[model samples]
Target: MKTIVKRSSVFFLICLILLMPISSFAHGMILKLEEPGVLKVEYDGGGFSPRTEITIYDEEGNELGKGPVDEEGKFHFDPGMKVHSAIADDGMGHRAEYKEGVEEKNIPKVPVVIGVFAVIAVIFVLFNKKAKARQQ
Candidate 1:
């Protein structure tokens, strides 16, 4: 009975884990204001976002510039002080918005990856009590 419970739990947990990235990819891309003019695009999961489109708008809701992010997921242009908002889109459903009053955090890649791994580790330990008891 315990084995069956463990197996079912593991199966469900794995399914949930696999689905996380797929769902996130559609809505997890974020645009960071890297010193006002420099815009950085990246997945919420971490690393470069391929072929993201970027648009910058002024305070009056006029587009100052619009273009594709580079292969490195970066776009650079100085729209001067009148900047109001920016949008990043991957054209595959992932979109992120940066507005004047609402600031999006530019989460560092290494730390975010580490945090995710840590969560997975915690979940593993929860399911496998024996694993935690075993110490090298």
Candidate 2:
């Protein structure tokens, strides 16, 4: 009886572990501006449906450009005019959008540079100490 219960418990634990990865997947999409006049779109969840469409528009509701997402669930386009916003639709109910001039917090470069130099200095000091210990 003990052996049978232990075996069943192990089997249940293994099944739970295997199914955890499937639950981690989330269904969503995202649109971002790569640069001035350039936009990128990406889809999450599973593979993109065929002919996933992306469209850019101006503030006045004028169409800027439209295209289809590739097999890798990504698309990029350059809108000739100033863009106000953009939208992506997989035609199977998944959709996402990006509004123009969304302000991303600017991270100052000086702190990042200083942190890198500090790490390098620590590594150099450790190596130098190790070499000296070896010589003695």
Best by lDDT: 1
Residue 112 of model 2, lDDT score: 61
The models' CA-based lDDT, in order, is 0.74, 0.66
lDDT of 2 by residue, 40-68 (tens): 56655335565678888889989978888
Which residue runs of candidate 2 sit more than 4 Å off their true CA positions?
1-26, 44-50, 71-74, 103-136
For model 1, residues 29-122, the per-residue Cα lDDT tens digits are 7777877678888877677656788998988899999899887788888747567888888887778888877866665556766787788778
Model 1 off-target regions past 4 Å?
Answer: 1-27, 79-81, 105-136
Model 1 residue 44 lDDT score: 70
Error of 1 at 2 (Å): 19
